[model samples]
Target: MTRSTLPIWRRIEFTVLLAALTVGGGIWGFVELLEVARDKTAHSFDTRILLAFRTPGDPSDPIGPGWVEEAMRDLTALGSTAILLFIVVTVLLYLLLDGKRRAALFILLAVAGGQVLSSFLKLGVERPRPDLVSHMAEVYTLSFPSGHAMLSAVTYLTLGSLMAHILQRRTLKIYVLSVAVIATLLVGISRVYLGVHWPTDVLAGWCAGTAWAMLCWLIAHGLQSSRARPLD
Candidate 1:
């Protein structure tokens, strides 16, 4: 009846309920952002937020020390396709070498699926990058949902959760997940600061990314539980 005495299935049920809520909320938020993206008047928030990062009368010069720009660029690279792919490759190789084929495969499918979904949504929305200000970062993709933000969430959060599942200590689990969340946040914020994406784009990316990552986690959890048949 108490927390310590609760069955494993019961704990899993709780997690399922939470993940369901997260997915539903994320979908709802993305829909709302999509509607806002279509409304011209509603884009004021994006303009104001983007311009705030620039100098008072100059869109070309961002308002900050030189190092700040460098830092933002570094943060942006953390979500770059090249960097994310490298991380994915390294993790997959490690898992495969350690004989965690199932986990490795799940990572591959989750990240690849996220890339596909990001592309589909970008084409579906066909939103343009913010032109109200000069872009500090070069981007060639459609911009409703920031791909960097989304993919970063998909990669870091999925890997973080997986690491948490592997580690034994509760503190370590929390630390790993916290770092993942922070990295995701920094990537999203960097997109906005660099004038490459509207704030709504980043928001939608975070929502969708979080939802996808959590759903994948739930699926992996179910698979793990099913495979670990315990004796009565």
Candidate 2:
């Protein structure tokens, strides 16, 4: 047989190594962001970035064209509780029907755990929403780590990584992962644009969400690797 020439990073062992690095880096970044958030003077940069999206005199008015405002609301919904529940339920049903019960359970636990973690983190930080700008959307929860940003990253990345695991081709795997990353990023940006979350809040969300998703992936990978039977 011809020798395989795939790069070292693409191999299973190296991929797991990279995933561990991602988890560690994400956790470190989140801790740093959390410290900055607690310091009033350190948050000036975050305030400046948040203000950039709004008009100088009127914090209520975002700078983009009218359509952009509407689009942002729609984008923000991607991370809403109702929409995320629907997505998880639908994916779980499909996975179950396809006889991939392990994957289905993985999805449920990862997303639900993320939801619980997000709630607790918000409560722990007890950070109030930015009063400097008028919120374009309604929000009732404490702000620090944004729920939208975190949930979107956790949900999309978990689903994407799971799908990539079973896919046969490298290109298709990359495509699935790219879409997941893009969706996560867009949701985070939409939160800032809509004045519902501080820039640092979204940053912390991304870091924590990414780390959680990768941890779940690492667990699933270990289990699957140990089994001789295919996941499906």
Candidate 3:
């Protein structure tokens, strides 16, 4: 039988298993990347990839036309602290007003906790911003895992999964989830294009951020399964 056709409890068990696997894999990938990032042994690889986005001789001039740079900056802002906070608060308020208090609280805890965790990781790693190219976008924080990348994944993925859960149609659910993934990816790429993050920084951000989101889902699903009937 297809997974969706399984007994409700069986489906829940399968989902929990998949999410746990994802969390474990993400954590493992992030740790391996972290060691490379810490040792600076990946400098050559990082530099080569970073420069690929710039003109052959001009690291200051990103490879795109002027408008493209502006566009990337705009894309990058979608992951900014201000934008993410606004999105989270808006969603939280909507969920509360709609009587989904549990969901609202979960979103708040997931995003806010992810933000705090990202800060701790950055501070602990103390990796410097990439100096291989002139930064096209302004930045003030220390760089290890790109904050924009990690937070975007955390926020968007959490929101996406919630959206998937709410939608009635399978296609609609897939569409929303795809949009979330694409948005998260674009933000990471924009950071590289803007020369604000090393390639590994973005990779680590994606790994950790995805793990955090999945971890949140696993917790929520487990709690819900415990409280609800098996048929639910």
Candidate 4:
């Protein structure tokens, strides 16, 4: 049969395959980054990127107009714990009110579990914040994998995927998913630019978070698909 004639379930099967590949890639990337995090090359790379955002003569001043720095700070805040919590609570409330109690609970648990995972990874790695350049933001935590980057990816991607499932229009679904990806990238970049996280930290965070989000999606999708399948 031609592509246009393929059943919707076939398309869903393709998506499941793709998501599985993504999960594997993300996990592999995270592991490789973890292995190299303490090496000389990684250190050099991290410092070079961190200092690139700073003025040549002074690492204290970022290489940008004042407003640029301010904007970066604002972007980084999008991934802040407080902001993320607020977003989650709002979504949970909406889902519950809309009689999607199961979805609400699943989302809450996913986000909360992601938060816990991030914390555990931080403790396991115990990497210190970058000191090669002046910090543009205040931080008090280990920095192997950036919590901002990881949590933002987890929260935004999870919400976006869920929203896409509910949205009827293909265009709307794509737009929501795109926004989630862009938001996650911006948050990670902001962390590096602010000299609070090493480049590797953000990369590792992205890998771990993407893997986690995709895994959750796979599980949920599988459960729903099984329920919808007709008895043989």
* Higher-lDDT candidate of 1 and 3: 3
- Against the reference, the lDDT scores of all candidates come to 0.85, 0.87, 0.87, 0.86
Candidate 2 Cα outliers beyond 4 Å, as residue runs: 1-12, 40-42, 228-230
lDDT of 3 by residue, 41-106 (tens): 557879899999999999999997899999999999999989998999998888888877877877
Write down the RMSD of all candidates, one decimal each. Answer: 3.6, 3.5, 3.7, 4.0
Q: Tell me the TM-score of each prediction against the true structure.
A: 0.89, 0.91, 0.90, 0.90
Residue 109 lDDT in candidate 2: 84
The segments of candidate 3 whose C-alpha lies over 4 angstroms from its true place after superposition are 1-13, 228-232
Enumerate clash totals for all models, in the order shown: 0, 0, 0, 0
Give per-residue lDDT, candidate 2, residue 194.
90
Winner of 3 and 4 under lDDT: 3
Tens-digit lDDT string for candidate 2 (1-232): 2235766555658789999999999999989988877765538877898999998888889998999999999999999989888988998999899998877877788888878887877777867888888899999987889999998988999888877887789999999999999999999999999988899999999999999889888887887778553356
Model 3 RMSD vs true structure: 3.7
Better of 1 and 2 by lDDT: 2
What would the per-residue lDDT of candidate 1 be over residues 1-232, giving only the tens digit for each residue?
8966888767657767888789889889989999988775548788888889999899888889999998999999999999999999998998888877777887889889988898788887877888877888889888888899888988898788776766679999999999999999999999988889999999999889888888887777777678552110
Candidate 2: 10-residue stretch with minimal lDDT: 1-10
Clashing pairs in 2: none
Give the C-alpha miss distance for residue 148 in model 3, angstroms: 0.5
